[model samples]
Target: MRLSTNQVFNSHVSSYNKGYAELSKTHQQLTTGVRIQTPADDPVGSARLLQLEQQANLLGQYKANMTDATNSLTQEESILKSMINVAQRARDLAGHAGNGAYNDHNRQAIAAELKQIENELFGLMNSKNASGEYWFSGSQSGIQPYVRNADGTYSYQGDHSQQYLQVATGTQISISDNGFDAFESAKNVSRTETRLDTAGPNGQRLYLSQGTVATQRDFDGGFRAGAPYRLEISGDAATGNISYEVYDKNNVLVPAQDGGVGSYDPTLENPKISFLGVEFTLDAMLKDGESESDYATLLDGHSFEIGMAPDRFATVGSSASAQITDSTVVDADAYAAGFPAGGVTLTYDGAAYQAFAQPGNAPIPSTFDGVSNTLTVAGVEFSFSGAPVAGDQFSISADSQENQNILNTIAQLRQALEQPADGIEGGNLRIREAIATALGNIDSGMMQIESTQAHIGARLNSIDTLTLENESLSVYNASTQSLIRDTDIAEATSRLVLQQTKLEAAQAAFMRVSQLSLFDRM
Candidate 1:
């Protein structure tokens, strides 16, 4: 079979070209250090590599977020530590200012120092971060958190919304705390007062000791604001026996324990009365030359109110002027749980009174008794003394728990120290009370700051944990990606040498075959 010279030349050229192409491909793989340079080389492995790359990018972003969060939280913790030290100093000054031996000049010196501390605290509370954003400004990082008011009081302008940073997949951490919660919203020390609502015929006065809470949980659950318990006295002057009936804020009779009746023996010294987690002593201040027996008869219609002072109580509308006879809290738990933070408002439309929560004007379930002139709602009772016309409104506001800001506490202490106590009515007593309140409030503020610091610490720990996990995951991802996309250096190098040898043989054979042909054979 005769073969053409063109066919022999074409066959050798094709073999040489195929061998060179194989050798070039192996060399390219070795240079790039990747097994599959394009999707056509390994389609499934290329797709998997793309997924791993995207995951790695996401992990990198998460690490960046974690770092930022850590920095922000660390800054906050440092500021809070400084603020706590300032609060401790202020508390010490308050204790010193309360000394009765200290004269006006000494008090003035303390006041000056307190003013400086107040300013320092103010600056610390409004501290800025590395990015020039306020640390305690909630989500409004650009805005200042606390601002001084015209009346020397400090106001929190920032909102209560917290800022969060995503530290990992399906994980987020709070990076900022609001000023209101950290500085202005500490609980105040609980206290109660007793006042004579109605005097007896003989102008006799009922004396009551400061009411004290025996059980905090019970008190928080049972006590009511604006609602005072009523104490009525009834006795026979002849027998010199006095019996009392206690009524709660809801006007419901408080039954005696062990089925016993509430009785007061005037013969004994100042007797103690206990009810609803509160305990206080009761006594009578008689007129001149009057005996206990004579005062007992006059006390039949006398009544006294005992409860916490209301933050706000006012009657609105011009047509009808009604006085609040009694404002008492009966269900403290209900009020705390259901009452709006903004407060509540009651309006009378001539027939019945309607209760509405503040801010959004949401309706609250309330019942009004026309015969008793009482409105009961949110575990509190409001009693009116006069007739009301349509459009008459009554507003009663009291926080479920009282709070005083650290700045206000400092301002009050400074004012007390600066005021002259000489020859003023109850001036010394007022200063003492102010100092005591300041001390308590400062402690509360310190607690709040410490709590925030702890929360910041917790977030930092979480960031650390997430960082380690992210690192581990990154290592795993790198190993998997290497397996799928990286070249096996030893195997590729050997394959490249073999392809080179084969290409050399193909070239040599092609040269000899091209030279042969029919002319060489002749």
Candidate 2:
């Protein structure tokens, strides 16, 4: 409280320093466009700014993810579109080749074009992304999706699991689809069929029909359903001592129902070999050698596979037609002899169902289950259309999954076209069937490719939506951050002028007070 000149001068000096500091801070805020140059300038605002910056960074990252995902999806869609085009071309070729008038040379030429299309499709399926990773490889993007094996068949090496990118909060989008689902698993309609691959005794081979030899009933049986199994039948035709051996897909011998080597009883009316819910009767005819031992020896190592045969349905009647609806076997021999007007009845004797023909009952009325698309008569599934009063008849034959892929379809067509017309008993008929099946598979492949492309398009849409959302969020974050930490230029300029005036006044007062001190006046 003492009115000393020295004290007054020192107080003025302190006030001037404070005013100068305030002016400098205001100038810094106006020049830099930020209210808080350091945390001490505005601790709470600085904390808020830090939070807003973190949020903005997160949103930016989300936007980046969306961009990457969009790129991948777009690439996938383009590749799939190309593949669809290739498939469509192949389908057209198949359609042209299927014409009955086309000669073997014509078919072979078409097949050559189809082969090229197949290779192109294979390339598309193994397409790479911007990062050079396979687009359809699923989670294994680094590995190629498909590889050609030594046998000329393509194998899908990619896993089924899909990979996703986090494009938004709690949102993920798949960027790729598994090649298997896109290329291999596309089926328009699932039909049961068997294909025969007989080894040894060329002349003894049953002019094996071009349809399913076995149907898939229960996939959860002891034996694997999708995979192939070998059925080896060997024994003396004279003594009828034929025994059958069964092997699984891995070549491991599969035990019979009794867990022993499956035995075939010759005494049974139909000498059938049944395993894993599939049953097919052996041909009762003897070989050319004609000896019991020779028949047995020649039949040695004669093996055929039993598996889920597909695309092997045949309708035999011009009017009332029959198609296979279930996995049950239709004895081609029996159905042909007694079908249409023959009146076949299914006899279920508590344990199992059997097909029996009522001799007098011609044009038998089949019990049709429309829901399952099945008609049961004597343990065979015949899907019939239109009402058969008494004499209407039709029949379908065996089928399998062989030649299901585009490559295999083309291969079968080429083989059929290249083979001599008079080679086999039904050579022309078999070639016709092969061409028809190839065309059907190509159509199905086209459908699958289209579906996959549609899926990719949807993903691209989602990514665009996410990207817009991220941009909006980023803008919001920037505005909030500015509100918390950016300077108001008008307010800062006003404060700077005021602070400059205060500092000038304080300095003038300090100078006057210092002059008034006793030592200065002396």
* Strongest candidate by TM-score: 1
lDDT (0 to 1) per candidate: 0.76, 0.62
Q: Give the best candidate by lDDT.
A: 1
lDDT of 1 by residue, 226-259 (tens): 2477877776778767787778788877768611
276 Cα displacement, candidate 1 (Å): 5.4
lDDT of 2: 0.62
Clashing pairs in 1: 224-329, 226-327, 226-328, 227-327, 227-328, 227-329, 228-328
RMSD in Å for candidate 2, one decimal? 21.2
Kindly report which residue stretches of model 2 are placed more than 4 angstroms away from their true locations once superposed. 1-9, 188-190, 194-405, 517-522
Task: Please give, for residues 389-451, the per-residue lDDT of candidate 2 as tens digits.
Answer: 344343333323432445555555565666665434555556655655566667777777788
Clash counts for the predictions, in order: 7, 20
